[model samples]
Target: MRPFIASPSNARRTRSREGFMTFSPRKTPTTSQAPQGSPMLEWTGERYLPWIKDAAIAYEHLHRYVLAARLAEGKRVLDLASGEGYGANILAAAALSVVGLEIDDAAVQHARKKYKRENLEFVTGSVTSIPLREEHSFDLAVCFEAIEHVEDREKLVSEAKRMLKPDGLLVVSTPNKDVYRHESAGENPFHVRELDFEEFRSLLRQFFKNTGFLGQRIYANSTVWQIGNAHDARIDEFVIARDTAEFEFATNDRRVPLYFIGLASDAALGKFPGSVLIDCSNELLRQIQEALAWRERQSADRAETIASLEKAVAWRQTQLEDSLEAIASLRRVAGELETGNADLTARLRDATHQLGLIHASRGWQLILRLRRIRNKLKALVTFRVPG
Candidate 1:
């Protein structure tokens, strides 16, 4: 899995998780070897980091190792460009001795600490110029997902050839350029030189004469067998017609391969049956369940929002009713004040009329005359006493 950092759209991202591929070896160190909550390395979109938990990438990467392990039993093995060294660890389980050659020093140290076995060793070295002293030492050499990453492709292939014995086999895999370049997410950024099917075959043929090719792709499949026994299996494919919805049987899977695996050796190349890795973890089923749970959560959130809005509207309606009642009370008070003002005006008129009638009857005039006579008498007395 070469790193092609991509920001897929919503639809594409969903599709990526729905499909599944993986190998389940009895003692494979793909995931369990790493410390809890700590992976050896972070996934850079280029190399397969064991703890990534991606079903598709796991199948694409580890299934190739499964094929290699089948051929590696009791043989000296060389794992070139072993990123996290999990593949080397898997090969080590079956081989007499295994050496994991890597370009990054940090990765070598991490692999050495993470995956430990007496037969397994980790060393820092480039694929183009391997650091081992012995020539033609390894019986089997496995390089995967590393060819497209190097500047010197030929030197890398030659180094693998130079390290392998005369009858040794080198199993390598590369992405099909046709499909890889036009992937839905985007082209891989880390790949320097991707090859088409023929180009890859020709490149391997330059080093070894006998070569075998295999096309690899991910597809959803159903498997059933006898409960207590194993038997031969045949593959059948069903596909829908392009023009219509009619179903038909495909004689062969001729679709463009997403990846290709090449088998090369000076001796006659060994043949193996077509291989597929099933995810025993049921990762696809889990993804579907998670999607359904997400939808339920979304629906519950929408319901809660609607209920909050309804409560706000009800509160506003209650406030409007209270305002209307207050306005009616103010109107009643204003009516009472207007009626009291009219009665007061009528009483004041009545008092003014009564005072006028009393003045006309002469009582008020007689009182004023008496007050004037008193004032004149007081003046006469004062004038008589002044001589």
Candidate 2:
């Protein structure tokens, strides 16, 4: 694929920077393996990193979901930042043809060797300057976890728009910086800027007719890390200017949230009542708030029930210990009695038997109490009381 000459001067200037470069190291292609193109892939050595495997899997699953919903069979697909070719390979299983481009040579080689499907191909290129020449060539484009690495994000969005068919769909995901603070202290050396929800939305609004952000994926809570991963990661999908009317009304009505799903088309503009978008946005926000409130109440009830159970357990344990001590005292008294003191021994044995029954009853009682408390908590948390 030939690289587009959209910004040759900018690329040259970036290459000539003399200061301590903050940008990640770019990969150099082998002498014999380099493609005969102006935009030689700058290897970032990211493919050799072990974390990329998990990242690739996550990207693949997400892309499959988006494509299945948006694209029909035999649609042309492009996998932007298609690291190690895993995403493209997955997409190739459903799409007519899939083209994947990456900046890492090792990744390109790995993908080429492992995934040799006939409908799939891989190239080395950058998102800011895609190698393809045809405008409106692709029906769908998937760019995941790539915007943070680029210096000029606006240009990247423009490039994506230029390459898409008028009504083509673009699915992009980025980390929610507001929800997740980079634990690495911003020293990754690869990422330029991490964006929160609003920043990302603003960037996309400049090019695409419609943009919608989806909330993060949820996972089990971790005690080791205090923060709950609630709506932490986000994906933003954009559409070109085919039906701009729908999006224009939505934007004007201020119905879209920082994270949402939206539909847009140029033909949709001025056709629908603007108030419809407002109502939809309001309804969505209300639902989200209600869900969050419900979750909080459930968590609180659980905590209270756990605390009560612990207290009951402690009390039962103390009672059992006291009964044991009493039984031990009776045995000592029987032992001190004369050898022929059958009455004293009999009394001690009876006392011990009674204590055992008490212990058993107490254990059952504690169990029942805990069960009742749990049931009550569950009911209280989940029950919708009638007005």
Cα lDDT tens digits, model 1, 1-387, are 643333222112211111111111132234334565334554445478776656678788889998899899999999998988889999999999999998767778889988889999999887888889999999999999888877678888899999999999999999999887777366555566789988998999999989998878777666655566545455444443344576555546545688898999999965577866768788866866887999999999999999999999999999999999999999899999888988998998999999888787778889879889999999999989967
Candidate 2 on 109-224: residue-level lDDT in tens? Answer: 76787678998999877777888888888877777666766777788777887888888777676656654343223333444566887788788777777765454332212122
Would you estimate the TM-scores of all the predictions? Answer: 0.67, 0.45
Q: Pick the candidate with the highest TM-score.
A: 1
- lDDT (CA) for every model shown? 0.79, 0.58
lDDT, model 2: 0.58
Question: Candidate 2, which segments miss by more than 4 Å at Cα?
Answer: 1-72, 182-187, 221-387
**Cα lDDT, model 2, residue 256:** 25
- Candidate 2 lowest-lDDT run of ten: 271-280
Task: Name the weakest run of 10 consecutive residues (lDDT summed) in model 1.
Answer: 14-23
Distance from true position, residue 308, model 1, in Å?
A: 11
